[model samples]
Target: MKSKIFCDNTAALMAAVREGAEGATIEIAAGVFELEATLELKARMTLKGAGIGKTILTHVAGWKPSTKSLPDPEMRLDGLDTDAYLIRLKRDTAGITISDMTLLGPQLHGAIFAWFPTSLHLHHLRIKETLWSGLRTFGMQKAKIHDCEFVDAGGRWDSGQPGVKGGITGGGIFAIWMSDCEIYDNRFVRTRTGPAQEFYGIKVRQGTRCRVHHNTIETNFSMEFPFENDEDNEIDHNVCHGTISIPKYAGGVVPKSGRTFHIHHNWMKDSYALEFVRNGVEIDHNLFDFDVKQDHGNLISAFGNVAAKGPASFHNNLVSNPGRGVIWINEVFNNLEIRNNHIVTRTTTTPRTEGLFGFNPGSDFTSIAIKDNLVECQGLARPLLRAPESYAAIVENNKLTNVSDAKKLTNAKANRPVGLENPLAFRCGAHEEFTVSGWKVRPTKK
Candidate 1:
């Protein structure tokens, strides 16, 4: 059941897809195909184009998306408007590949919407300027979306719209209930401003065993996996100008393989690098480089009555010019270990005398360990620990410069993280001509 069609116009393209058998390959020619309605993707088919920017697909002139809010059976949400998408996968579609075209949008929802697709592959496509999101999915498995560009891809999160935090907010790639997916080597950028200016780069809910790496995202919230039982997720080797947010106890019960999430080896330039607490997570071998002039936010912060189930650890990180100090836990947390890091702080407008680490007095200090750290503060003296005096017993073998009578001070060398080089340095975006490594601190591999 294999067939091939070469089409240039909308009618030919639509007829080719509708009539073509399974395992068909439709190669769209170099022209602008104005879509009259949603293009349904068939199973085991390939939608090919001449090239990006050479072949374009967009909505018809004066066409508008339906304002109806329809229920999505895949996500179990009554918020999505299916009439807003240009291309959609057929129910229970599998082994579909869409590549080498521009899905231009300022459309209502997004460019491509799918549900319950298996082994879907998307590459070398530019999804730009969508009102909701560039790509939206539900229950996608073993999908690979790489080398794509999402430029100004999402906005429009008004109240009661069913998004992040009940606000209809979307992102460049918003997928709910995804598993075994790999999203890498993509660039998510916001170039222009309008009502479509607020969203995340990659937003996932209940994602399991997903690997997100080698991306250069410039959105305000680069990556978010929040408020779900997301497990066995790996985030590493990327360049993020915004926050890598995984808060609200997103890590569920640790699997027998150990650790719900493994986050490491990423270059972070934002002051608010990471968000709240979780259990059975290991964060190591990362660079948290924040400029002194940026807004004040902690590198790691948690607040409110967070019933944290612990055994989370952060070690071997290099932090520079922390705006409001590191690791501020406002509530009682247990089984957190912070060790073998180097932090350097300079004189800033904010309080310079605050402790580098602060925890609630009611926390189980016996389970917490802050050891083998090297802190160097220029000009003023800063306290090592700001909690109760009992915390002093846990703060052992730290080298705090210019702090008088530091308890258990040691002359041993700090265990700095090796191979802290930026992986995406000197690499530009795949489609666009944007330089990724324009930061002040660019580390090359030695």
Candidate 2:
């Protein structure tokens, strides 16, 4: 393996990159390297550093040079004309690996920007304090980003930058038009000290065959799938401490109609665990603990004309302490299934609110099934499922506890008092199961 060493100069580092072979590895020594301009990378090489905090790369102060001076410039750099990035991977570059480095961006842009790379890997990196996203990739294939930390990204509050007008920007990681990417075992935390914006921990648009799993995401908006037109993408086994949003039409871009999105085996501690606007989505085997005191604490909120596109299913989930309801169905649908789930709510001092499940008025349905579920609430004063008189649902084999109203329970196959002694226990993967009684549901079915 051919190698070159650079101490603290980015210009020399670029020169070394230009002289290195295709499979060479550039070892950056421990020091702070202030970049006067973006280091354009067009070769299939490895940029390795001593360690995360030991080797830091930062942008120059108030210096925004033209991309023409870079090694391989593209017209898309016009979007970043006024801003500067620490590293830019050319579209022609492939098999590039960046590991064990700290990247700080003060230009209100991204730390690393890549376009159409065939292969890329980023591991063991600490990317922080970016004005916009920490890592932005467009049209990349076969990418792996793991064991990295993205902190204090989307620094709009501190940078005084106006909110993004049209496109989705300012996040920990933003990938547009990507394919076959794996982002796992990473940490995304927004530590900005100010009002939050419509940013996300990770945002993917028009992506295909991506896997975002085992990530610990903590931000204002944890994840967003704005108009994903792809198929067979998986978002599983993630610990999200904020809302997972699928924002409505913003800036003339509506959620694209898609198929086969598997969202399962996740732990969410937010008001809205999964808020989606499109159809053809499956949400299962997740634990939602709504710790936020919001008026509309819903486990799943499906909006738009979802029934027109394709079938959607929500099953085998556990919801605990939902402030408002369990599922808020806004639009009419042809096929919708909510089965084999558990919802538990405790008595609250606030006035008893609406039912546990609310379906909007005038919403027509062709085929809807709600079965084999359990609702255990202590202090709710309304019916468990509220629907219009015209809307007829096939409800069966559900157990209710401490609910007085029987208007919606007329179709229940069986009603029995919830046993408090056995309680509920849940475990994901190979971990030990933890038990919680008196209102918490188990991860799996009884």
> Tens digit of lDDT per residue, candidate 1, span 1-446?
58889998899999998888878999999989998888888999999998889899898866676434522332564666766888898877999999999998764568999889999999999998776778989899999999899988875533345443323567899999989999988998988754437778998887799998878898888888887877889987777888887775523566776777888767778888888776778887777788877738788877657567577888877778777778887766778888777777777676556777778777777788877776788776666666664353365666678653365333344454322222323432222233334233433433
Kindly list the per-residue Cα lDDT of model 2 for residues 1-446, writing each as its tens digit.
55655645677786766676776778888888887777776567789888999989886676644433222122244545433678888666899999998998755466888888877999999998765578877788999988899887653423234662323346788777778988888888866545543357887776677888878788767787765455667887777877776533311122354444788777777867777554567787777776535545566676664434336777777777776677776765436677778777875435446676666554444466767777777655446766654236666677767765555454456453322213333333212222333234354333
| Every candidate's CA RMSD | 4.3, 5.7
Q: Identify the runs in model 2 with alpha carbons over 4 angstroms from their true place.
A: 1-8, 64-78, 155-169, 196-198, 247-259, 292-296, 303-307, 348-352, 362-366, 414-446
Cα deviation at 172, candidate 1, in Å, is: 0.6
Error of 2 at 428 (Å): 6.7
**Model 1 local distance difference test score:** 0.76
lDDT of 1 at 181: 97
Off-target runs (Cα >4 Å) in candidate 1 are 66-75, 157-166, 194-196, 249-251, 389-393, 403-446
TM-score of each: 0.88, 0.83
lDDT of 1 at 275: 80
